[model samples]
Target: MHSSSSSGSRLSLNSLTFSLPLKALALTVALIPFHTINASKAYQYDAVVNNNKLTVVGVENPSTVFKDGQYLHGFGYDLARNYADSMNVELVFTTVPDDATALKLVDQGKANFAITTTSIQNIESKKLTSFSATCGDLYSLQKNGLNTQLSWVFKHADDPLTQTASGFVCQGKQSGSISQLASFYNRNVVQAESWDSIERDLTKRMPIYKASFQRTAEKYDLDWHFLAAIGYQESYLKPDSISPTGVRGIMMLTNSTAKAMGVSNRTDPAQSIQGGAKYYDLMLSKFEEVPYPDRNWYALVAYNMGPGAVDQIQKRISAQGKDPNNWVNLYSYLDGNKAQNGRYRQAVQYVTRIRSYLEYIKNTPQLVNI
Candidate 1:
């Protein structure tokens, strides 16, 4: 439940009552501060209990603490978050360059502890630091026979925090929580349930409307596969498809959207594809501050939630000190005041399915010449 934020002027939650238009919102840079750990013994317990912050440092490893888009995710981040939660403290993660730096940070008392994906012995062999560990049983020896187990490296061998971490790690392992977290975070999350249908559609239906997607996307300066992915997600490339809400056709355009895009017929496959591409391009134009692929994702979300709501949410995110322009960061805040639980989940699934479909479309060979 720990979230990172950029340094900015803090805004009062009371002032965020009105919805801000997309064009009027300001963007914040995503930055992780390098916090120096307090060296006093009196600060340790007081910092965790009174101050309520647990700062830890680690290197970015895919299976450990890598950054995806604007947010930190992976096993190390989750483990550290859980450890902080056990102590009732907010987790503050700082990224180092390598395992050696991570261990050094802990040994020099710069961080409370460090999470290592490799063996403690490997790091200990090189650094003269007297670091001890509490977690590693979740992993086995590497194929090369080196111990590649994940562990937490703390400064003092007999610190109270170290012992508590040991107990937590042991309990997590016993409960299969550690292994489950590792397995879930390390998997290919991009391959979703919609893949099979997308595959089937690529062969059967995509060839029929590929030219329309390409022509409209090129006209709008967009990726044809991106347009086609939206097409598949909207109507599964069915020209006659209609939603319960009355949006219909290949791209499932609403009557208003169809007319705005100059489409005469919502059921006309080419016109619908043209309208969808044009509308997505319009969404793309609104998120210029967001970087390429993430901007594309924001546009996709805007397509679902509308640009005004996306703008309002982004403003709320900025007021809380997180970067609003990054989709991963943006997505992390979907459980908003407006839609707390299930409705928020559907919005997340929409972006995920479309993103997977976009990747699938990009990889699949084009069957028709544009």
Candidate 2:
């Protein structure tokens, strides 16, 4: 196993940044791939939503909906889009600062469901709206493979970073029972900084690294955004970075992983990127039937948790009525892998965040077409 065995430290979705200014420009689009029932749709859509012009109130939550001013994503966006399409409506999306505001909009009938973890508890107090099926969840891994029992005391339904409930704060190697505890007890835990610090440090370096990403991605016929996103996620595009588990360089390759891919220096940016790309392609080859986008998403999960882990999840997905090759459906199935203890969730976030960043890169003026 790679040195980064501890799931908490390695699969830290809490570390993903959600800092982006909300712009007045509501693009009215659906970015994710869901079918549209109509062909006579209107015109001039930015994101990629339904046709009925449905409006939704939300917050800048990348965990559920990634709002980057130009585009809105995640379950909320997809839900609204699908609902609108089902009803033949167009999609309109908005973001606020907190969950109370979002839920209030829904409670008052100003928009659709609040569609957030925060909204879950607050809705009970309001009578104008009803909470539907578990719209979404804030998944946090106590540890990798401790025990996939989702039985933690899911207190603090809104705050997940401090994920503590009934004095059960999860720690390494002793957390396999967390999910079981949380589930039996019937609860779910809920859960950035930087200034120019991240921007200033990464500004100049992004171009050089993105160029590397482009080259490596093309060499393998892979999506440049994906290869780059993995590099960015693995080491924040830092060629010299090292992970706690001894993963090194921009791609965060473990020593054995690196050597197996013919990489002599895991710290070298080009060597690491290319090697990581090769490894990723190898993983992608495992699922030949999955369509694009979803296929890429599955491959990314394989890159993180191993193909065996992905295979197990896909098997469960197939067992369910959902399509195992479809990422969006498969993603929901991952949550059902109660035995994996949120490792699947880690992969889900890993892919979601990377795709969002890829979208961000495409929208960025300086970084476009790199």
Candidate 3:
């Protein structure tokens, strides 16, 4: 069945709902060098249509919207092109050095529109026309930099560096990619630390692991946010993290899974994130019959409790004529088993924390579905 959304509350697609609220705990601050920029001084968020014929956008990640040998590809690129086609306007792609420059271009009428992931605070200050949409596939990994984590950054397409993976989404709105992304996560994460602690120490290793997470998550056919949530749940992203049970490194994989994923050293951030993503990918494959989001939960539970344990539950659910694919149904079975309930709670909290953080980055404070 196709679904639509109300304009006041949503854009063009069905809303994504992950009901989890995690308390942002008391964090211990640590400083990490962040490559940050502000668009407040550079451009306004309002749509400045100096010429109806031209729609100029500022771009940071050109791979997202770029032309390759007469073929156009990228989420943002396609979005801009499609929108322009709908409006019967000419779309011009321009190179922008920074947010300030992009905003300045839009403000000075050098460009009709500037597209970048500029913070929301700056956008409001400038009162620029925002499409009121952002790409859910894009991730905002700010260090423990509160008041600095970042908000309201829109994506631009046509960067030569972005992967043209023959990806096709629901064909509308910023959430298209994000909705697809939601299919890759689950609620079976082990919550080892408070949100506050993760917040405080995030900056320390975020710079180190963020790129690796993105790279590995992409390779494993998962969203970076899913792996990131797991990383946070496992060790708060501490590269040197070692659990009491001896699960090692950022993604906290046991030595067996790590070695199987081609990780020689679990303590290595790159190895850990990549290995963990691969392991989770395998878990996802184990439950292909499950639906999205719920499928993600199944994958997560399997990741936490191992495929063997989850397989037993699935068989029992099937034997009882219950749906083995629905997370809620599967959870009902788990809830009845006292031995597994403890892990179920941890998984819920795990997914909740990650989803909450991802939701914040996906939308601005004004539009966040909290």
Candidate 4:
């Protein structure tokens, strides 16, 4: 009886050992389809290795990146193109709203890169991939100097040699030469140093010489830079630069316009700038219904030719079945015998200049001071 019991226990132990392998085999069989499905679902992005096709993403701001119908500019646009060229890839851009969103897209593999005055911080560096080389820092070199350090300068696109630098790139049709006029930057090319200097310069120049003018600009909710840009265009910031067309002072106020604005002295820098700022504010208000890009162009035309001319252009633009407030669509209607005159021609050129200048400021940290 003892021998029979011992044999029964041994038989039971053998059955349990055999059942373990069968369970494991069943589990293996159950997992086979899961493994196969996972393998089939695995996806790979079509990334160009060492190829020049890169997708860059950034914020969609006028200062960052904007589309004027089909035309595109701004530092972010230029930089993406440049970097792609360096890598021999065609650049594709996707515009977002802010840096945090942009970085998130990159991390999620929606875009390969992000560009928009991106600052490399410790936290950010660990979170996402960035260029080994720092980009978007603005610097200035002495006029006529050749130090590979990029500097910001205002130049006509038609100028002979187009200056393409780190932060600012000019596209123009003229053959005139360009020279840098200021060395407001340090030799250090790091992003931090460059950004710091630009902020410092901008702060120092933010205070307009006249407190009243500053107050008025604030009251009108106008950017002091837009006012400054107007001053720069009018007289190149020269308090006494007078146009051959009878415009005077830094604001380039015509005698009639000045008198209308109640400006007693068009030659006084403070008064002229204030008068110009006020006039611009009025023009901006008059076209409050117009779309942006167009509104800016209209304000410029009003500055150059007169509000009457801008109204005429709007009528022509409307007659042509285009939106009068669409600057990109309306600009073509402004050319030729219908509006062919030096005044209109100058207005066209001035609009382009202001657009480029605004683009330059938006991209380059160095020019933020202006």
Candidate 5:
């Protein structure tokens, strides 16, 4: 009887051990499929309201609505972020060779959006899976004094609007025309010292000074004009302007930025503008994820007080639970004798002037292209 009891006890212990293993094995089996499903579902849509992971495809140039490095400073960036934020998802940008590639990427489902200053047309509308909305402004650059038609591609074939619009043409040769237009539209225009003299100065300035600015602008994918705007704000386009803190030249470059830009003469007009433009371009590149309208403000602040300070302001605003993109909301937090000082206020004013200038130039009968 004792032997029988011992055998039964041993059998009960074996059952307990086997039962535990069986339970564990069942749990593992259940988890394996769950992991697979999660893995297979790599891309999810509408994950959050204002944080969608969207891939924007655009060109490689600085003027493009979606520049290579400055994805957040143009109309494309603003529209994408606005849409994503409304949906609550993070935006992801994908740079493309051209508009064709952008379209192709979207059609293939490789990108969630294509925002390279696209015009809605019947052909593209049918081909692309997109929503109907004007995301940014379309600009035309024409030779000064030439009347040209501005073209628009409509979504509907029978849309009752002309494909081309007419506007006044500005004589590029007019004194202060470029500057005036720039101030009006908040966009920058290159004013050659003189068409007659540019050929002479071009050779002199090209390699040493202009090339550097061009290279930096290309590197950061920023409009040379945007940099010029910073220069205008900083030093009023005077390469010889000096600040109390010893900031010099058109860009009001300090000794440090000038040196970093490889400028040997901080007072030279060419070197000053070049260095300043490059520096502003760098600042423009930092807010690549912000929308274009808001990006300009951030760029202006960064241009005035350095990007680090602008970042601090953004953090402060965010901490206070306000939208950093909203200039109205950001202005209150940016004011006071705190971190950014009146530099923030000055930056906002400068940017506002630039924007107004851009609009004015666009509307100006003398400057508008027909």
Candidate 6:
């Protein structure tokens, strides 16, 4: 985690930075099949060419791959989903018990690739398996003399799909889509100087409204921690907090928005939290065409910029012949337009800051069950 002073902590879309914990890196001592296969040989598989389905296997890891109800979501899942989208194929995800099982399924041709938590050095030195581009945020585990990186594994060194996957990874990284995805998924949470105050609030203030956040979040099928992040961002969890713009309550809802959400009293904590969750769910439902995780991000952007503004940006994206459903595409265009577009920069920073707070909330578990 990188800490920046509150005065200087506004991260731009292109240069978001965070570090993986060394202890977390030490836990991923996984193995892959060792072989001396020639890398120059051209290889193609019938399943990949004809099936029109991208089968991916991965273990349940919060940062890599995990289940949210019926949906698979994480950094690796989104990465693989992007690759599948590029191929215009259906993504079929299978959750295995561990990295070894995921790799075995790939080797047996049951899965095209495995989202494995290992190092580039490990793959290069001993593993016959081909790997996709690094997912960024590389950390050196000096004790083991290995560089920890998250990558997808394939069965062969020269598979044609491997090259395709690498290309997609490279493009995603270059466009800042991958890092944005990482941020949205809480893969790397950057702790700023405000973190200390947030920690204090989590203990002193959050517990006071935890039940309301949890209650409304469950009602709307949303994460309470996420709702709490919005409250903290908006009004620092003070129900009576009022903005100069007249938006009030912990969620800082406008008068029109409060009325639309059926919020009678914006100063009431329960009503405010409920209204925020329902409004967020409404925003989320508007972007159902977008994939999970990205869908969540688009909804967050919508929450900050209004659904109509987001729609306009999506239209602009489509007009440019880009994938509007992909937030990275949205982010890339916004990044280029930031100098001339205040709304673009606001939406980018809004979602990024919320995700960071959400990550901080998730990491602080003691406040839960209070």
lDDT of 2: 0.51
> Which 10-residue window of candidate 3 scores lowest in summed lDDT?
24-33
Candidate 4 residues 233-341, lDDT tens each? 5665667788787888878888988998889998887788778877887886787776443465567678777788888878887888756775443444444433657
How much lDDT does candidate 4 score? Answer: 0.48
Please write out the lDDT profile of model 2 over residues 8-92, one tens digit for every residue: 1111121111111122011112222225423342221211223335555556543345543334444334434433333344556
User: What is the per-residue lDDT of model 5 for residues 137-256, given as tens digits with 9 covering 90 to 100?
Assistant: 113223321112212222222111111000001211122222222222222333433333433433333334444454655665555444534554566455677989998886787898
Q: After superposition, which runs of candidate 6 have C-alpha atoms over 4 Å from their true positions? A: 1-44, 48-53, 58-63, 66-70, 94-111, 124-126, 132-148, 171-189, 192-196, 285-293
> How do these models rank on TM-score, best leading?
6, 1, 2, 4, 3, 5
Clashes of each: 0, 29, 17, 15, 26, 0
The Cα error of candidate 1 at residue 286, in Å, is: 1.9
Top TM-score prediction, candidate number:
6
Model 5: lDDT equals: 0.44
Q: Per-residue CA lDDT of candidate 6, range 167-266, in tens?
A: 5566555655655555445433334566777788778998799989989888876778778888888888998999788999999899999999999999
Angstrom error of the Cα, residue 121, model 1: value is 14
Ten-residue segment with the worst summed lDDT in candidate 6? 1-10
Candidate 1 residue-wise lDDT at 179: 45
Better of 5 and 6 by lDDT: 6
Evaluation by TM-score, superior candidate among 4 and 6: 6
lDDT (Cα, tens digit) per residue for candidate 1, span 312-332: 889988998867875545665
Q: In model 4, which runs have C-alpha deviations exceeding 4 angstroms?
A: 1-56, 59-214, 335-340, 359-370
* Top lDDT hit: 6
lDDT of 3: 0.50
How does model 6 fare in lDDT?
A: 0.66
